[model samples]
Target: MTTQDLTNALNALSTGEHQNAIKGIKRGIERESLRIQSNGAISPTGHPKGVGSALTNGHITTDFSESLLEFITPVSESSTQTLKQLRDLQKFTLENMGDELLWPISMPCFINHQDDIVLAQFGSSNIGKMKTLYREGLKNRYGSMMQAIAGVHFNISFPESLWKSLHSLKQSNASLQDFISDGYLSLIRNFKRELWLISYMFGASPALCNSFLQGRKTDLPFKKLGKGTLYLEVGTALRLGNLGYTNSAQSSLRVMYNSLDEYVAGLKKAINTPSDIYSDIDDYTSEQPKQLNKNILQIENEFYSPIRPKRNANSGETPTDALLRAGIEYVEIRALDVNPFSEVGIDIEQIHFLDVFLTYCLLKDSPNMDWKEQARSTENLDAVVNQGREQGLMLNDNNTPRSLQSWGNQIFAQLTDVAKWMDKAYGVSYYSETIERMSMWVNDPSLTYSGRYVAKLKESGLDNGHFALELANKYKQSHIETDYSEFLKPWLEQQVEQSNEAQRNIENADAQSFTAFLDEYFHKN
Candidate 1:
């Protein structure tokens, strides 16, 4: 599809014929946060029992670390409803948590050592063991320090009606699933080129505990903050930069989204291709494995991208296989930092902006990006991650140097039109209002979340630890003050029991040995 395809689709949809389809754009959020002790250190406790088994609970689960809680909400059309579900999940967990507070920021709380961060245990089921083992591989490959950091994931999909309308508009002969997949790939390509704007606007990890570095780093030009914290004065999201979850292997990995076939083939090759560097991780003799296969990637999930084309895979299906089976169903955006200011970790304003920005991405002209272009896009994102608020930082835009502000403003200009279209589609002014509000951040950096967070840390005359500690306590108090009535309590209690039963069922259903299970899973058709 070219620029004219977008123009035709939008023009046709604007005539009110597909307003319901446009409004049916669905979204869900998977917000991750660390459970912290009262002193703001990463909690060493196991998953809270009241939240249910980390293995089988649909709403609540553990991420890489045992203390890192990931709360997921089901798909919803309304952002307000999604946020409400997210809040209910959090409030319910907090009510069950005994004196533990959810870390408000994306960067982790203080940990004395990497080993202090335990792998999230998922009971004794084969699938559960595989989940933990994959994380174990991550720890050996990249260390537990980076794995402890948290972020928010936004999952979105255009409705089937919208897809059907676009297909009809294009008059394409491709299968509907293939058309949907290609359209999402188009959106992914555009999102890659423009995701730097997201880091600039919503990033909130400008500062972190000095202990985070574990005393091995240099050359970031970070300033000391009140003795125990290190920070970049102009940094936007340090978590997205070199200091986050990265390794030397990732620099050499190239997983592209140019098409469904090319994307799947790239990942399939990575998982099957052995890595000389990783081969000797455990000598392949230990009863317990240190890493998964010593391959370039243990699984498709190991391929990290800011956004991914996704489908709801069945019980034993891989992500790529699921995509190959039914084409793309949705997209998962992994760029957002956990909002420190919001009790829910992400506010509706940000969601509104994302809806507009992502819709713009979907409706904009998208061309196939080659390896060189992907590298250029990566460089743009890294520049924004590191020096977004820097006074005159410029980025490479198709080899033409443009000031970050100018580039962002250009994107926002188009996003304004997208927002207007969305507003008309949804019958609300919030989308347009969100575009206007976010545009101010492009022209004025001080209003951005990371900028404001850094300013607050400085004004408080405290280290990152203390400032975060204050916010953690403040949010905990707010949760405490809100009456935790029993309306939501009984259902959660039932859910916990149900999830535990499900885990038992999974464990009971495991007829194969763990080794056979691993071999079968990796060697599955």
Candidate 2:
């Protein structure tokens, strides 16, 4: 589509008129889904098998490592096989973790591949003590447990050609800051509905919301609900959690500048020396201990630059104003855990539901709705989490309360229209089937396996640890209970063969010492 076509489509959605917004959302979902599907089913390289299904099972205690190891044993047998499989699983888990819990199946629009992302470091329980651990250098002293927080990374992507054209135009008449501001304004104007969709998705899941809130230090103004905190307070938790931590506005700019500088330097080097070996030399030397240290430091700088200075006060650099300056259009969703029950990290059906829900949020018209209305929506989300089926939430339309089931039905009805449009546009019959299956999950509570599992767990009164142990035992029994000797035979034989090959190579080598043989072996490879 031409830029104008895209601009017009976005404008239609952002009008915030009920029917117009629904039409715009329908068009956008179809277009975006088509673009992504054309690129290929987002089969990210590394993800644990069965993670999505496991999460749906509502059994949080299943050990991810056990299930992962089981899935790979049937596929390959190499010394590095286990490590390679684990890495892939972790990557998949991290990527699809947001599928069930957050809105908008796609990543945030502001994130580019090259943009700097940060993951905050704060212990699950004592934020204050965690700070103390870092302050007293106990992180180094205590090691693993002291460094308990998960680190999040941010990256951004943009249309490079369009960006260049815009940059050139700005240079003739405007400053860089002015150009960036104007560019973002245009981006928001075009993508606000999509952004709101993202916010709604993130806000829908209390479990995911807790991920951003439970581990932070913040003092923002908050709304309370009868001694229990409101969902907006959780949003505030994310704001405070990430304010000077993940995606610190100013730090990202510096990282971007540094990346550009590095890119320029590499370009200059390539221009000066046409030989392919010039780049290869750097790669070869990277393995050397001294060079490896330097490479590690560079990577750390690029990845951690956004939050490092704030983490270390002595660094004296202050955070950028980018986050505060921009309107709060999208909130990051971080609370998804890998489902141990699905063959893939997320199910295709669940992803389809996510698409429908996000589109419904974007298409819904009510920009003038007060904070009270927003709070009600947030409460509905919490009710879904805490007692979704038991105490069905009340959805508000223009300040009127409706049952959650009724609201869901209306949302799915819109999805049906989008599905019909997509089937016609993409010539895919499965599109309708996918949306239909998703609609069943919403309309028929019996199909909600996640909620059922939670109910079972509560009925059984099994604590998290015991429940996890039982699941892990089941996994072990499924794999290892079958003749142990037969299972180990293939792996052991492969290991023996590899060891013999290494021995032969060592025996034939002319190296004077073992260290020399090691160096030569690695270097040759």
Candidate 3:
């Protein structure tokens, strides 16, 4: 698109006229009673459970043993069965829950290697240890064990090859059966696309190395870095890994690399090749070499990796080995927190809004944008996270201070036009709803997840742990109300059984445990 064309599109979108559109859509949302009651429970102050103290000081940590196994598994080529199983397992976990502490810390998956490609996949709760412990048949056998390890979470990652496979599949006029069998492939592809779009918009660029971390010195300083990838806080990463994205960092990096390479190549080709149809594009031939390579590797290793180490030194796993094994590409976005109130990590409406916002970031011409803008954006993110919607917390824009609501409203306006375009292209009514929701958020920032969370904490008169407990209870209630609870029965049974067996084995063992057993079970040769 021409510069003027782009500018007009943005102007139309940022006008904030979609408020009425969202009000209409709100009728479709299934409303439930908001139960606000507090039971006295204190949130754990320091770090999440199951991670080392060294790694817990506000950075990502990993189980190197698990990472090593995952590296060889080729998790990207997971099948439809695997995806369904994961969804089912998650549903099951949501059922029969107590506090967050009693939940499984990680979502378990099995990875299968296919030459040059990996298929990382999650299992049904019935398949492994899950069947014995938490299932209905075994609940009495392991209820106590379940309560002790509630807050754990984990996830798995698949390879880029899987997306390529899906893209190829989409090209064909496949029958319904074919598509059903390949649904997981399609889901991953969509997820990857969303990730790519967001990464390009919010990721740190090599050019503005001094900005992302507020001028913190980077070991791999480069002249230019791309924007758009989201950086996960230490807490978020730990929670996600515990939830079951086993290869969260590695899988995320792969998606970023593949997406970025494609994006940059397309842009470079467009700029270089003369296009008679759209001849108004500017030339980038004068771009410097330093500005080109961008030292992406250095940025990934020096700044990003250290903050979220894949394995601990005690585990004999080095950051270098982890990156090499996982074929680390670009940085990954791990900052997003799933709204406990929503069924999915992100709602479909929010996804639609994000699409427009991300596209705008990409299509807009911002060659002159520098580190200062990056710094300002970082500050804005922090403010939104910690003090969002609070009185006196305003985001600064180009030296002018503006209320977050005003800035958000301006963004919503741009989003509205984008949604209209999408509605025409995709024929989906949801895009318009997305635009509406964006307006709602802008008009009342208190409706945001963060804002709601703070509010809930205050209203419940409980600490963080109790709030988490209440959320868990609500999720359980929702799960029981749905049809997916049956699938969880077997897995829960197995988990209970497994926990019982472990307890029995411990009771029979000598007070002084056998050194050989510990060596064989806990430590790798």
Candidate 4:
């Protein structure tokens, strides 16, 4: 697709819109934060019963570790409402726990060793056991320290009306679901090309406590701060780089995104294919299974990506099956870092910017990316994650070296135009306001989150651990003083009981043996 193609698509969207098409966009968030003790050690307790059952609660759950809490919000079109829900959830959690504070940043603070991080647990049901075992396999494959790292996931689905308008504009003969899936794949491809910009702006894990690596070998140039803190002068998010959440074993699997069938086929192949590296670990037949299977990836979630095409799965249905069943429902953006600036990890300004950026991704024409382009895109992301704040940083745009400032300015111009259409839909200028404010950060490195975090540490003459603890305490105090706004205490109390009862029902309903359940889950239609 050319520039003219983008113009035509935008023109069609504006002229063909009906019944507030742009206002129909639905969004939700899954934010993760680790629970830490008063002195900044990882909490050793289980998921708090007052919070709800980790296995059944839709609003609150544990991610990889029992201490790493994940907060979810209900779907809404308004960013303001979504954030209000997020704040109340956090406030409720704070009210439940005695004094445990949520870790404010992506990289954890002052962990002793890998063994100290505990895996998340669910109750007696087989599915619950499988969830815990999946983390066991992760611990066996990668260490627990990597699992402790936290981030925010943004899930968004375009309004069905907007999809209808686009489908009509294309005038194609394919089904609506197929067209939607293809359009999302195109967005994924385009996002991969420009993800470095996100890491530069929102990435906050530029520095980390020395023990985070667990004394692993590395050659990256890391300079020391006041005490025990390791940092790179020009880094953006080390959590996104080679030092964090990276898998060297799955380097050979380049999953395709040009089509849903191809993407599913790629994941299925990885699931079924056995690996010599993982085969040595005890698997499904073991008395206590150490891993799910001997494959390169035990399950779909293990295959990490910055974004995934998502469809809410049914009971016993795998992620790939859900995609093949209904094409695609929405996109889960896994690239966002936990911004330390906000108590909720993500603020409305960021959400507004995301709305404009992702809509711009859909409106812009996206071309299919070959292997060479994909690899180049990864290289670009690596450069930004490591050296985004470097003075005179250059990024490769399809084999051409260009200044980051020039590329960022070009993208923001398109984003501002897209923001106008989005704002016109809701009779509000929030989208344009967010874009204009963020545009300045693109030009000035010091205004970015990573830059400000490093500056704060330096100005205070404190290490990463002390600085994080201060912020965690401050946010906790703020939450304690405020009353619940969106979700009241009465509603939250009712939800906790409902979630626990739901977990009990699932446990009582399980009659089949664990072996049979696993077999049927893999072989079912």
Give candidate 4's error at residue 34 in angstroms.
Answer: 0.4
lDDT of 2 by residue, 1-525 (tens): 233443343344333332122221110000010001111122122222223222111111011111111112122222133223333333332233333111111111111121112212222223212222222222122222212222221111222232334465335476444444344333322222122222222222111212223354545433333222222312211211232123221221212211222322332332223232222223222333211111211112223221111111122121221222332222122222223232222333444444444333322332333335434444444344344444354544446777756756655566676555444434456557776776665554544544443343445555322333344334333433333332234443344355445434534543344334334423432
lDDT of 4 at 404: 90
Residue 115 lDDT, candidate 2, scale 0-100:
11
Ranking by lDDT: 4, 1, 3, 2
lDDT by residue (210-229, candidate 3, tens digit) is 22222334333122212311
Q: In model 2, which runs have C-alpha deviations exceeding 4 angstroms?
A: 1-87, 91-331, 335-340, 343-345, 363-369, 391-393, 455-464, 470-525
Candidate 1, 214-296: lDDT as tens digits: 88766888888788888888889988888896667867777788899999988898888889778888622358688767888
Candidate 3 stretches with Cα past 4 Å from truth are 1-4, 7-87, 93-332, 343-345, 485-525
Candidate 4 overall lDDT versus native: 0.88
**Residue 346 alpha-carbon offset, candidate 3, angstroms:** 3.3
Candidate closer to the true structure by lDDT (higher is better), 1 or 2: 1
Model 4 agreement with the true structure over 122-154: per-residue lDDT tens digits = 998989988998999999998899889999999
Worst 10 residues of 3 by lDDT: 24-33
Root-mean-square deviation (CA) per prediction: 1.9, 17.6, 18.7, 1.4
Q: Once superposed on the true structure, which residue ranges of model 4 sit more than 4 Å away at CA?
A: 1-4, 16-20
Q: Which should have the higher lDDT, number 3 or number 4? A: 4
- What clash pairs does model 1 have? none
lDDT of 1 at 432: 88
